[model samples]
Target chain A: MQQTKQRLLTGNKALAEAIRLEMERDPNVFVMGEDVGVYGGIFGATEGLFQKFGPERVIDTPISETAFIGAAIGAAAEGMRPIVELMFVDFFGVCMDQIYNHMAKIPYMSGGRVKLPMVLMTAVGGGYSDAAQHSQTLYATFAHLPGMKVVAPSTPYDLKGMMISAIRDDNPVVFMFHKTLQGLGWMDQLDASIGHVPEEAYTVPLGKANIVREGTDITIVGIQMTVHQALEAAKRLEQQGIQAEVIDLRSLVPLDKETIIQSVKKTHRLLVVDEDYLSYGMTAEIAAIAAEHCLYDLEAPVKRIAVPDVPIPYSRPLEQFVLPNADKIFREAIQLVNE
Target chain B: MAISKDHLLWMYETMYKIRCYEDKMAEAYAEGKSPVFNIGAGPVPGEMHLATGQEPAAAGMCVHLKKEDTVTAPHRPHHHAIAKGVDLNRMTAEIFGKATGLGKGKGGHMHLFDPDVKFSCGGIVGAGIPHALGAALAAKKRGTDWVAVAFIGEGAANQGAFHESLNMAALWKLPLIVVIENNQYGISVPKTASTAVPSNDVRAAAYGIKGYYVKDNDPIDMYNVSKEAVERARTGQGPSIIEIETYRYLGHFQGDPEVYRDKNEVTLLRQKDPIIRLRNYLLNECGVTEETIAQLENKATFEVDQAYAFARESDYPKPEEALEDVFV
Candidate 1:
């Protein structure tokens, strides 16, 4: 693969660039959402495309999530690749039928005869205290459902590359981006979110995990913003003579279990950090994987940190207490290593 | 139907209370959120959807309802909750995440549930339409005159639930009234860009139901139109749709940049403020005394102030309380 000149880009701009390049490359590709047009996007995922492609290509639908999301699946079935944004991932309740029942099942329900090639991109994760409805990173909820390819990118480079790859893929892909990583002026952003994204389009295939850090004592697995939190925790753990390896599980549905298994095998300990709920979520899934594959290799029971099975609270104090942060991760990592 | 003196007083008092509460809420929402407006920084953290300019829709329609009737409101729900007679202290405490809240701090401002007054609201755009329909169905089944009202924004009228619920209500002849508070915008997207028809009342025809449109933001107009609709529902005719051209004085959420709308738009809308119009009508047409008007204003201020004080002094729920209420 030929690499192009790299420039500093936020996670949102990288995503927008990927969509722009894909739309330019393929005439069948288009974008639609609540505020995707004129307002760019509430999270800036579809910025500048509305002006470049106009309303026809970058359409703005009503607050009818079921209608628009279902329309995306229908449009995809007819050969047009629609990259529809559902604004917030929390709003999936109204349109989950169209997603799980239709969008996910169409390809298999038709026995591969009808290919519903589309991307359902939405803003996920909760940190700035937008309350329960506005703030949620429902990764496991979507991943638990089969048929959709769920990918949540942490940095600009991976977001750009994975977005391009998701567009070119033949299956329905769920692209989840965190609001804090979008690098918008209003919200406080993480330093790790801004990275060198290649000017030209590239493909980072889905279902592959990136080993962001290497260690020997334990493996810390995370996705989206949790990956950054895991890395921060790993850095703090290094001072205490504990070397923790970090794995960014970019894809959830087609999970990179091999990478996780190999890393856990070498380390003999594992800690899964997730922003989603603790019960029946990504942590449980990863813990089950380790228990199934390397039951003997695990020196201690698989420790996991996540939102404590509760709706994202609105008040700052309560919200901070429930959210999975670096301090919580570090404390949990220490406990895992000691155990 | 003629607007009686008592009805006029009730409308004015309700609208005044809503305005006062919203004004105080806006001030409280701005606390700890200055210089840089971090949404989570304030004492009242999270999104605050203030019903600043859309009080008439609630006052006019709710003035006709009883305690047994159910009212389901949208995200911007303070006006409807107040008009529907939800306890101000508990509702305010809920917004402040206090244990004394309606849902014991578990449900925030958008998810206010007060079974006492049979009032509840949801954060989702059109999610409440079906809930109102179900309530209306139960009322019809129980052989009662209890009606259900769902107050939704113009943008929500385009939702699938809105259409589905309307069709079901019309088919079953349920006692439901759908009020479309056409406040022009759903966040940044204007109603013109979102809805297929100019007014949502026209969509009511598709369900074979009577539809009424309120062009002005006048409470009298809203009240007169709602009277017929309410009568039709209570008499077991069917459901009705009322699309009121209201106003949203503030941004979609507090601290919104609002680049999509013109800066002067809110100012222009405020010139013909519904509260002021209603007050003038009461004083001039109804020959109400200025002292009586002053008394109502003082009462509204006093009640709103008490509610705010109660909310501030109340303790937040124990952190462990979040684990509860997921089930029974």
Candidate 2:
């Protein structure tokens, strides 16, 4: 058996390490965004990249999202794989046209003549009362739009591997990493945030789901930080008679429906947990999938535990009320398994 | 500076070709327009934003550009595409939504893209400004002298992307040229109502870049300014903004009632048409024969006819082809 060599890393550091590896591998790769150079990124996804790559490759752009993002599109069209940061997923409103129209549609519009091998990385999720503007996990919004791949990594291992894959992918990829999962020293950390990542380069593949925990009673689906919540909830459910199966949907765009369907077939009960809002989101989509394909196999109504259609409030209690947590996922999974 | 006869002849031919091509496009669009707006109802459907009288700006600016140089234009980009030496047959077929088009029928006229000549345009106003800067950045990073030109109207100068692009280009000293075709209208709203400044070139001062305003829509004057700007960019002197005062002979789109502009203004602008002025300059000043000018016009007309026929005869893309380009 091959010994698993691992080094502990935060999600941000893992992403930066992946970027460093890709930058070392290809001369055409570069990073650009607001405060990405001197400030080392608002979330440190680009920490230490400036010193390694210099200012030529690590560009500090103005707060003009439309201009710099569109510039990334143009640069990508010209054969440079630009990794641009949007700071926060909530800030996509300022430059949605560049994201949806130019960056996303350019390849399709060019009829495959031009390839936009670029990564649009941004921090997502809310945990520490960043208010409504700063704390949105909007993976669903990008996933809803065509012509772009959307991925959210929960573990340090997945972050490093998927960041590499996203940068190397020929199409545009939106890599949304949850802020709470970054394991930054300044922010409160989750046990699931820091993990053993391999030193060598690898890709986890874009559209495959990882069965982090196996059980037969019920199936639990989650992404990003919510995946960690589902795992914790699954552990708690294991103390009871219910054995919950946890599936982490790493990539939302090229979704691993086969894995989801297979898990649903075995478990016969489904519960989806998402940090994003409830309506028209990942949870609803998963429920729709179960309803469409494995309706006969389902023993109970599909349950969803997501943000209850409210903007993340500034108050801690109000914010906690709207967010999906392990307690909420556990309660919902218990009802799903028993019902 | 004295202009060479060959360059003058090339400029005239390019301008004439743009004029012929746009005129034919307008006629075809008019023929295709039905009472009800159905996207697939016409031979050339969708919004046809014709650059009827803005040919000189495209010809003057693009004549100084090489195939390796990149260009990004607004929705009204047929003139720029033709001026940049994009395949006319493919471009027209793209407008006709054919499988053999430049974009394989995925992008209609407003969203034409041709990587061969490094030309692209988007529907949103001022979106191309930053894209041009990006292309310029690519060239600079690759250690090449190839520059990029972004064309926008005076109306789009108010957009944040325009200001940001200008500032970044100047800051990075990227080889970029921004040409503002001040046709005095942004869709239906006149420039007077939309922009606070009378001259769009004056706005470039905020970015600490050189700005020029050409009073007349004369092709020779435009060519002179563009040559200097293009040379400055190629030699690494950084970016410049040039605003050309011109007029569009037709409505914003083919079916526009044009309630915004005074009727006399259109008539007066038509009297100072750049194509006619260029032809007269070639005849009276450059010592070119009338027969040569006639031959160029005839050739342009012939090419437009051939492009139209090719587009008309081309096949529509298969329905399954839409899924092909979405990823790769």
Candidate 3:
């Protein structure tokens, strides 16, 4: 076995390391976004890259998402692995035509002739009350669209590994990182945000779910920030004589149904926790998976805790009330385990 | 061509109204958001993009528009909306997320849609340009003099939608006017670093359309420039591009920690506030009295105050009401 050095690192640092490693290995790999160069990314995803690679490889672009994102697509088509940042996932509205119509559909439209290898990374999630415009985890929105491989890792290890895998992947990938979990000084971070990340470049393959905690009573599934919330809920549930298994669904498109189904088979219950809008969201997707395959295995009906379909209100109290929290997940888990 | 005295006074009053309204909004937006500055804690929550120093761009161009014309604005839309004659109380109520709002609290400040005044705006940078194109296309098809105006920032000019819309507008000869408000910055990146061209008006030549460039964020300059463009569009002479050099007095949004820009930049820009410049021009060049200016100022302040009071008194929509407007 190869020895790997481990050190505590935030999700942002881990991501930056992965990109730096990949760019060094591959000549085609480059980074571009609004502040990704000199600013090192507002969320620190591309931190320290500009200093190392210079402006040629790490480019700072204008606030034109359509132009640069579309340009990235063009560059990718012509044999370049471009990792473009959308700044914030909420800012996709202006350039959605290029995203949904062109970038997402080009491969299929070209009928296997053109290979568009690119990674579109963006910051998502909201706990800091960034209001409606800046604060949103539109995971389901991207996952719903075909031709895009969507991934949102909850840990630094997963972030670094998955980012490496994404940079090398030939297909288009949408990598989303929760701003709060990036371990930035300005934002509040959970203990789970930082973890022992390996120094060597290793890839955590896409379309796999990580069982963060093992339990027997019920299975709790979550992604990004909600994964930590689920873990917290599981810990609290353990004191009540309930064993709650926590599954981190790092990939959204190639959803790891087998792991979730197996967990439900052992636990006999399922609860989906999400930060995205409730209706037609990840919760519904996970719940549907259980209903489809493990319906008979589940002891009780599946439960879901998520932000109600409101466009995240600006008032703190209202936003808190709508958003899914550890307490909400715990309450739902307790009731599900009881039943 | 000389601007009429009545038109000059109208522009001044409108500029003053926009300034007063923005001042009131800034004050109200700070309530419950202090010490720590939690963005969602305030009364007028969400992203607030105040057009504090952009009154000249709005008032100058909008002074020529009639009731039938459509005006599409970018995220920082209050100045354009006010200039286009949107109801102040309803607009305020909308920003406050009250049931009596423009969209019954469904659309916030950035997503304001006041069809009564043929005005609408969205949070997206260059998203409104195509909408203005469609409106202008409709006017041309209907054989009407109703031109559509799309007010976008300097940053938005770099968007693919802006370029596409310009090409389509020129090719079809639609009665459209695209105003590029060169606010020197897109959040933090300056125009010099972002834009490839020294002047955006030069881009109009590529589309074979008339181009007008306004300097120093001057209201009268903007008015003089837009006058010929407006007449050209109204007479079915296709579209025109008007690029005005302007400055943003506030941050991109409320609560934005603007570390990217020099702190002293705003103070230097404020030294040449467009409203004050227009007021001085009226006083010195046009022989306008101080009492008249004071009356307009008082009127604008009173109207803005009444709107704020109305917004404060209005009730918020029911929590379940969020589901109502998604489909409609």
Candidate 4:
């Protein structure tokens, strides 16, 4: 295999690059959805794909979510691995019946008779002024589905690795990508870190949570943009001699419980930060699971720093007020360890 | 055109079975013997949607398909599931949320999966359309002489997936028969308002395929129309969408008041009830004696009764095993 290197780009662009790579590797792979080709995806996640792959492969579809998703299902059942993009996570209301009830459950429902190898990629999280109709951090809702693996990444490395893993995964997987990660500018740093990945086709294994920063005082769990906030918060706390271990839970459904539990056991305290609401969200679910499993190892009660339960307002200050940032996560972490 | 005596007798028999089975469910539900939220020892908290007035759609369509063929169903699916040769005892136990039911009591009324009997559930509205395509693809690939029927309602036709699935089924030359049971409603929403088009199958030319229509008041007409579509599909003529214009006589769910429509409309459609029409056909065309038909009805009723008895004797699932069958 030859070595392939590329210039630095945005996180969304990097993902678009990865999608192109996967398509190049296998003829069976196709990207289908609205505006994926000529429109270059809703946010340019699929720029330059139509010319590279053409309509037969990088096809654009009508505004029919279920039909296109269903076509993806039929294609997968007939042996093609189709990567279909649902424009926004919130548009999943009409498509939920197909994704949640059938796509997620059919493989198991058929007793392994059908292997649905499909990717339901979507743009999730907040910060964009798409209003309530466009923006809602809904990872928790899909995470509740049994047969689907929920992938939430906060960096380019995680994005590349998780996308490869998701594309290679046999079951139906929802890759929730946020608009915030493109700010990291980590694509250029890819070669500096993991070096260039092998040109030959491969897959990153599922269910492995990475410890982005290691410490011994308190364990911090963050997802997507929250991971970035946690890192900044950890840096600020390190000055005060407080070591916070950051665990990036890349996948949510087949959640890496052991990694989080083991990290908590080491730190004796835990703080969860998320962009979703405080009640019944991933933060709460993570806290509950940890409390039930690692209650005795805790020196202090687990804490969750989340956006208050409300619709994300459009104004910048109000949005900041509703979102959890470095100051909030830092304040929460310091309180848990200091108290 | 009225149904023949032979087909009319079969429809009457099927409608009788559906009625008997539903009555049994109502009794079970009333006696605290239902699944969901009650003793759940007898109550499983899951809502069950009974297919009462939708008998003609199931009976008429199933008439065209052989025992070896397939039918995909929706949430309101008990009639289709049973009509496809799924055991009543297992189905009853499922409705009661017992361990012995199909899907091991995981997918109550909406999901009645039977791979062996050629009946699988897409469960979600408009979702099963693709599974039908995939199965039809498999049948075509394996060179098997069978047609896959994707049974959906007027409401499901409004769904984008319905159009997408039909387009692909038409495009790939797959042997899939898409039967649209225009039950006039999807839950509380009426079809006339929900759908942008007057008809669903009429859009078949967009996918480069032929569309069909049937005013399915009589089971015989439904069977005949379905027969042509089934024959076309089995012969590798690609897919055909047969829109059966009918109405669901009951509430969308077990407790729907159907406040969405006028009662006068219901009364008008009921004048040509499939069961009565079939009975009339049997008397005029089949030249069969009333005693034999009565015996068949009695047998079906007895079978449904035994199914209830078997389901009642079945045990509840252990709490520890609650999460089983979620995966294969």
Candidate 5:
């Protein structure tokens, strides 16, 4: 199955399609979350799921994330493949105990005897008028937990593949699909640039980063939409006669350190671009690992292009000014190469 | 109808073990040998809800269950664990937070585990009920005669998990025994504070399941009432809500200031303590000899002591193992 043959779909729409396919294929698979069934998700990732799967499976639970997640954990323990939508990435704090403490740890706590196999889908990022409470890339928190996997697929295809893989995995998975990049508009660009991805329930086997374009000057590591920005940054840097390697780390956890390290070693410079704040988080973790293994490989100290430490202000200029765009990434890549 | 001598004996044994162990735990907690628990962390004043007054309900109801059958309970689960055949040594070790403990020192005393003995302990209040529902669903799927029991206190019965579990179990016709022990209190607030329906059984009509209420203090009566529930579940007739009307012999926890209740209330409840009632009945009516009773206590004490030793001697988990079991 070629990638372009896939019809128009957003990351959220692709998720909705996969939810339908998963429920269709497995009698035991059920999708549950707030408004997922009737109103679709708050972001509409589960649109039409209820009509297709019925209320029994596409349950609209009360605003009790902890209770529902815990119930889903129990149900998964009882052999149901439940894909739970958490509405937004930031609200994980409300049910973090169930996620990190209970669902993430049940399998190991049971002496390698239990498999949680629950998929948690949530919308992450700043934009679309959703305030600070709703907008933030907190995948790092889940990535740090043991016995859990965090996948933030930036496109429709990877979104489908990663969600399928997450559903099939025996351990718990938190799939953080970004608000800005979910949909089919990126398909043509991704197809033209990255080219030919295998279609099927094929797992891209987690912990691997894709080099959107190979370069020998600087390695630019990007996450989610930041990867797209990095690709544009690479194009601009190419115009500057400075070739930049673009690495999209699809999954934050089980990080594809080797790919990033090798890219940095070849490029001899490193720059990371993430939509998250330039704080003690995923970028910090990646920078630490790069410093530990491939610091000398870098001709310059690694630079991180991120949102300044501030709330994602709801105003247009404030939001645009704070977000890490291609220009910021391009400037950083140029600086790393120049240094 | 009165329960058989074996039933009474089982109740006494479990009650005694729970009381003795909890008493020891309280002493340990006071001595700072246990984990640091603030005021509201556990059913306090009492280190554990020894449930000294509620033995008959646990022992009598679970006496008929087979080893393969399962039970999911909350922090107040010492009685259920014992009744389900969890090894006292491992149970004690779990309470002691030893790696040899069921949860490998992760779950602490609040988290108990013994799938071999068919009992799982939940640290959260109502969290265990859904697992019990799942367990019953598993039993139903496996097409086994085994049934799962959700042992909850009055407090736990008010949790959303309990509500969702009951609704789901009834909706699916799962073979589950929802044993809601109404011991008059959910940690200070009386049962009246939480529910208008004093008996959980009335809620069964809402779901179309059969319901029963037991004089929870009488092990024999509890056994008799629970017999129908067990039989109903075992026969694939689906679940039933059975509320046992019992009393806690101690405060909601040990060392409770107990300012809420009068000395007379405690004295009156103690006068009809289930253990004493069962023990006296067994001796006077069932002709269980004092020698046999003494032997049982001795054995229980020895076993509790052995569990303590195992917990004390078991290695603490290597710090790395903390992250190891997060995924299995």
Candidate 6:
């Protein structure tokens, strides 16, 4: 009989462990960002890395996103695989040039002569009432741009694996982790946030979706924290006699449209749950994909449960109201199944 | 300051080569200009930001650099690309949108990358500054003495990336030299109108790094200043800013009507051309013979002609090539 060994870990811990493994394996790998060294990252995603890697490998940079991020691009061009952290995805405004113009466009611009093996990691999602600027999941924005592979891993197992894959990949990868799903000590997290992560270094290939729960009646596609919400909704829908298949879209750019279309073909119903804004987002793109390729497979008009087109509010009630949750996913799934 | 005769000749040859290549490009561009001005139909399609007058800075600074030293050039980058030892045949082919171009015809003129010489350029203003810093940081981390230079315009000095890069380079003590080719204009907007400070070099004080200013267009002076900055960076003295006040003889881009500057400004600036000044200095001070100068000029013209011929003979990339370089 084969033996399976796994350790329970939070999303943040798993990410750090994966980075530590890569640093140990490759001397070219280094970490640089605001509060990444001594402060252990604003959300503890980089905790214990500085002590283990030392200040040389685990560098603390000034709050200059453009400089540090662009530096990561240059370093990547010169064969160093740098994991740069943008404290928040919302702060892309200050350094979008480095991200889109250089990091994303260099390989294309260089005509395959250069490869950018860099990871731009940032914190996403907003359940803790961190206002408009602090709380946003803008994976769609990065995914929309060409030359960047955007990944949002939901579980500890997937996060660790995807991170290793991102580091090993030659293309520039944008790794976005939801704040609530990180399972930090201070932040309130769901039991689903902790998962069985293997100690060994492994990779979950990008652009592949994981079918978390298999069902028949409906297909629900979600990413990052929404995947957990969809799972919870799937359990609730099971109680209501509506079987919902949940898909965790691990990577956004190389979107797993095959799995989504296949699931929709089987279930005949589709509901996309996302924490990003409603319009021009991942939800809309998924809906469009279903309409474009698998229109007949969709039994009813594809339903989307996403944050309304509004900035995340500061108030707890308003924040919760705007964010997509299990109740929202469950309701949407039911309506899709019934219709 | 006494300069070697061979070094002066080399600088002059490089500058002359740039002038000849740009002159031919302008002529070719004019001949290819459609009555309706179709950018794609021309021999050299798309916007061309020619470095007509800023050749000295690139030649001077690049002369002091090795193949291992990296250079990140801005939009008007042909001069720097040539000076940094980019293959002239491929560069011209790239400008002509040929399959054998530096970027396989994908990166037009502005986005050239020659990894062999660690040279790259882009169209975005101030974007290359931080990239050069990153290159410098890589060299520093690897314990190499190779330095990285960022060739930016005075207009780019106002960009947030510039300040941020300068500060970071100083803090980390990375081997970086930021050379600002203050050519008096950013497209149509003059430097005096856009910048609050009198000179771009003065901004170096804000970052707590050394700054050097060259008021004239002499390539020797540029070489001297850049040598100091490059040596400082290679010796672990951190980053420094060197601002060279110069002028562009041509409009920002091809067919720019150039309604911004005084009509006589370019004419007057051409009289003080660095290439001419260097020829005179080499002849009088460095004892470089007129015959040697003539030979060098002829050689540059022949090389430029050869590059043009090579580009003209090259074939455009296949339509399917557009999808090739988007990833590794």
lDDT by residue for model 5 (A1-339), tens = 665563556566677767777788887788877888788887768878888878778877767677567767766776778888898888887777678767776676665556777898888887555667878887667777777888888777787777878888888888888766654342223431222233345565667778878999888888888888788878888889988888889998778999988998898888888788888877888889888998887788878877788878887778888888888888777777778
- Which 10 consecutive positions of candidate 5 chain B have the poorest summed lDDT? B39-48
- In candidate 4, what are the lDDT values of residues B1-328, reduced to their tens digit? 4445566567678877987887677556556543443433444344556666677778877876776576787777778877777878887777767788766666676776665677766556778887777567556645777888888887877676777777767766888878788787778777778887777778677777767777755577777777778788888888888787776766666545678788898788778777777777777778877887798789889999998888778997687666554433
Better of 2 and 5 by TM-score: 2
lDDT of 1 at A291: 91
lDDT digits (tens) for residues B1-328 of candidate 6: 5556676788899999999989999888776576777666678888888999998899989988999999999999999998998999998999888998988999989999999999999989999999999999999999999999999999999999998999999999999999999999889998889999999888888989999998877788898888889889999999999999888999999888899978998889999989999999988987888999999999999999999999999999999999998878
Q: Which ten contiguous residues of candidate 4 chain B have the minimum total lDDT?
A: B33-42
Q: What is the DockQ of each candidate?
A: 0.01, 0.83, 0.02, 0.26, 0.33, 0.88
What is candidate 6's fraction of native contacts? 0.84
TM-score of each: 0.54, 0.98, 0.54, 0.75, 0.81, 0.98
Ranking by DockQ: 6, 2, 5, 4, 3, 1
> Between 4 and 6, whose DockQ is larger?
6
Q: Tell me the tens digit of each residue's lDDT in model 3 across B197-229.
A: 998999999899998999999999999988888
* Ordering by TM-score: 2, 6, 5, 4, 1, 3
Predicted structure 6: lDDT = 0.91
State residue A130's C-alpha deviation in candidate 5, in Å: 3.9
The models' CA-based lDDT, in order, is 0.87, 0.91, 0.86, 0.76, 0.76, 0.91
Q: Identify the runs in model 1 with alpha carbons over 4 angstroms from their true place.
A: A1-339
Which pairs of residues collide in model 3? none
Best by DockQ: 6
Worst 10 residues of 2 chain A by lDDT: A3-12
Decide which is better by lDDT, 3 or 5. Answer: 3
RMSD of 3: 17.9
lDDT of 3 by residue, A139-248 (tens): 99999988788999999999999999998888889999989899998888578889999889999999999999999999999998888988888889989989889999
Model 4 DockQ vs. reference: 0.26
